[model samples]
Target: MDFRPVLHILMRIVLITAVSLLMCVPVALIYHEPVSPFLYTSLIATILAACAYGGRGKQELTTFKRREAYLSVTLSWLIVSLIGALPYLFSGAIPGITDAFFESVSGFTTTGSSILTDIESLPKSVLFWRSMTHWVGGLGIIVLVVIIMPSLNIGSYNLFTLESSFQEKIHPKIRSVGRRLLYIYLSLTFIETFFLLLGGMNLFESLCHSFGTVATGGFSPKNTSIGDYSPYIQYVITIFMLLAGTNFVVHYYAVKGQFRKIKQNEELRFYYKVTFVAGIAITAILFFQTDRSLETAFRESFFQVASIITCTGFATADYLLWPSVGWVIIFFLMFFGGSTGSTAGGIKMARHLVALKNVKHHFRILNAPNAIIPLRINSKPVSAQDNNGILTFILWYFMLFLGGSLLMAWLGSDVPTSLSSVATAMGGIGPGLGSVGPASNFAHLSDSSKYVLCGMMLLGRLEIYTMVMLFNPWFWKN
Candidate 1:
C-alpha cells in the first residue's frame, strides 16, 4: 500500500497546518486577548511539527501514487480541522468540542454558516483567526505548501490535482501554477482591502472583509454579514465577490494581456450570463414585490445574487424575508456557483455547461439515430469520459444534497430549514431559507445536525470524489 509515503506526506501537511495555525498567534497577541488558547495550540502544534520533522528524514518521499495522494489530502483536511478547533475550545468562545469542530470545519471548508450566535462579542483575535481559515482554505493549504517549499517538489502535481478539481491548467509546472494563482489571490485581496478602506471601514474590518470577499468566504466581522455595511461598501464587495468567483486562469490571462482568450472562455460567459439574468430577475422582484427604492432594490438584489451564485454567502438583505418568488430565485442560484477553477463552491458552471451541452447533443441524436454526435464546449469536442464524469458528479451532488436534507429533517428541523440548510451547507453557501436563514445562525440546531452539516461542507469543498473515494473498500486494497 506504500503507507510510508502517505504518512510522510501527511506529516508534512500536518506541519504546514501547524505553522499556519501559529500564524494566528500574532493576532491574538496584538489584541491583548487571552493568548493562552493560541499559545497552547501553538505548543501542541510545535510538538506535532517536531514529530513530523523527525519522521520525514527516516524515509525519503521521492514519488507518490494517486492512492497515497488521495489519502494524504483527505486526512490532511480532517487533521487540520481538528487542530483548528483548539483555539475556540481553549478560549471558551465555543466550549463544546462538537460546536467548535463544526465552526472550524465551516471556516476551513469556506462554508460561511456559523454556530456562533454573537459573532461581534468574541475577541478580535478569534475573529481574525476565523477569517484567516477562510483565506488559507480558499486556495487550499496543500497548494500553498507546494508553492513555498520546493523540497516537496516530487509528485507535487498529483497533490495539486487531488486538491484542485478545477479544469484549466495555468502553467506547465505545478509550482509555477501555484505561484500565479496565489499572486492573483493576494492581489485581489489587497485591492478589495484598499477599496474597502476608501468606503470608510477601519483597517481591521477592511482586512477581514477583504479576506472573506477574495476567498469567496462569508465570515464578516459584523453579525449582520455585509448588510451592516454602507451601499458603497456593499457594491465594492459585490464586485470583488464576482471577481473572486471567476476562474483564476481567466485572471492569469488578464494579467498577461490576453483579452481574446478571456473573452472567448465559455464558462466565463455562462457565469456572467447566469449572474446577470438572475440578478436582474431578483432585482425586478424586489422592485415590485416590496417598497424598496430602485437603487436599494438593485443593490440588494445584485449583492445577494452575486453572493449566492459565487457561493460567497455574504448577504445584504434577509433573503428569506423577501417575496416567495425572490427567495425561490435565490435558492436556485445556490446550485450554480462560479466558474470552474474558482474558489466558490457549488455545481460549478463548467459542469453545468457540460450537462447542458450533453442535453443538446442528446436532442440532436433523436433527430438522426445513426449520426455521430460529439459534445463540444468552447468550440472543442469533449471526450465521452469527461462528459460522463460531469454527469456522474452532478448526480452525486444531488444525491448527497437529498440525503443530507432528509438527515437534517430527521434530526428535528422543518422541511424548509432542512432542505435549505443541507442545500446551503452542501453548496458551501451560508444561510439558507428558514431557521438558518441570513438573519439566523446555525447555533440552535442539535449537535448531531451541526456535525452532519460539517461533514457535508467538507464533502462539498473537496467536491465529493476525493473524500468519497476513501470509503470504497477497493480504494485501499490498491
Candidate 2:
C-alpha cells in the first residue's frame, strides 16, 4: 500500500469537509445561534487537513493499488466522520467525544441512529448540519459504489454491472456516472423538498426532512420523528424514500424515458414485491389487532415498511407496541435492505433474491438430478462467481451480526436490546427492538456499545468486505 497516495487523498476530503462546515454558519445567524461552533470547527478541520497533507506528489495516485483503494475508501469515511463531530462538540450539545463520535458516525454512515433525546431543543444549525450529513453521506456512497467500486469489481459485484445485458446501458466513466448520479441525487432532494413545502411543512423542516428522505437517512428535526407531521407530509417523505431507495440507474433510464429497461429490472421488481407484501401484512395486523382506523393502519404499516426496507429510520408509529407477529416482521425485514447501488443499507434485495433462487434451484435438483436448473436474474444466467459472492456476502453479514450481538451483550446490554441495536447499526437502520426501539434513543447505551455500533455502521456501509479485509494480516503480507 502506498501510504502517501492514501493520505494525500484523505487530506483532500478533510479540506472539502472543512469548507462544507461553513454551510452551517448562515443557519446559525438566521436563528441568532452562536456561529463560533461552526467557525472554530471549520478552522480546526482546515488546520488538520493541512497537517494531513503528505505533499508526496499527485503522481502517486496513478500508482494507487487495490490495497490503497481499500485504505483510502475506509479512511475517507472515518476521518470525515471524526471531523463531522466537531460541530456537536463545539456547541456543547453533545459534550462527550464518544457520544458525539457515535452521532457523527451514524450521520455520515446514514444510519440515523441518534443519541440526542431532545432533538428539537438543539440549535437549528446543528439539526440542519445533522441532516446535511445524511444528504452528503448518501451522495458519497452513491458515487463511491456506483463509480469507484465497479473498478474494484469485487466491491460492486453484487451491485449493478458495467452495462450488462440485464443492466441499463448507462455510461461507466467516473465523471459521467458521478455527474449523472449527482443530478439524480439533487433532483430527489429538491423535488421532495418542494412537495414537503406544498404539504405545508415550513422551509427549514421541509429541507431537513427532505435531506433525510432523499438520503434514506431518517434524522428528523422533531423528537417525535414523522409522527408529529400530517398524513400528507408523511406520505410525501414515504414516496421519496422509495424513490431514493430504488437503483439510481433506474432513475437515469426513466429520466431518459426508457421505460423498457426499468421493466426488466428483477431487483426492482423484487424490491416492490417485498415492500408490497410486507406493507399489506402489517396493515392487516394493525387493522385487525388494534383499534386504529383503516387509513391509519395503512399509513403506519406502509410508512414503516418503506422505512425499514429502505433503511430509513423515520417513524410515524411505534411498532414495538404492535402485536408480536407485526413487530417481528419489522425485525426480520431489517436484513432485507433496499437496492444495492442505492444509499439504503443492509443485506440488500439482490442478495435476498439470489439466496431465494439458490433455495429453489436446490429443491428442483433434488426432484430431478439431471435437470438443468440455471439460476438467473434479469433473464441472464448468473455466473458462479457472482452467485458465490452474493451468498458469501449474506453469510458474512449474519456472521458479523452474530458476533457483534454477542459483543454488545458482553458490553452489558440485555439480549433483545443488544441484538436489535447491533442489527439496526449494521443495516444503517436507526431504531431497533427492546430498549433501543423506535421510541428510544441510543443515549442510554454505554460508550463501549456506541463505539461497537460505529464499527458496525462502517462495516455495513462498505458492504463488509472493503473495511473488513484491512484486518487481514495477509493483506499487508502480500
Indicate which candidate wins on TM-score.
2
What C-alpha lDDT do the candidate models reach, one value each? 0.80, 0.88
Per-model TM values vs. the true structure: 0.92, 0.96
What lDDT does candidate 2 reach at residue 374?
88
Off-target runs (Cα >4 Å) in candidate 2 are 51-56, 60-63, 156-162, 165-172
Q: Model 1 RMSD to the real structure? A: 3.9
Provide the clashing-pair count of each candidate structure: 0, 0
Which has the greatest lDDT? 2
- Model 2, C-alpha of 289: deviation from truth (Å): 1.1
lDDT of 2: 0.88
Error of 1 at 345 (Å): 0.5
- Residue pairs with backbone overlap in model 2: none
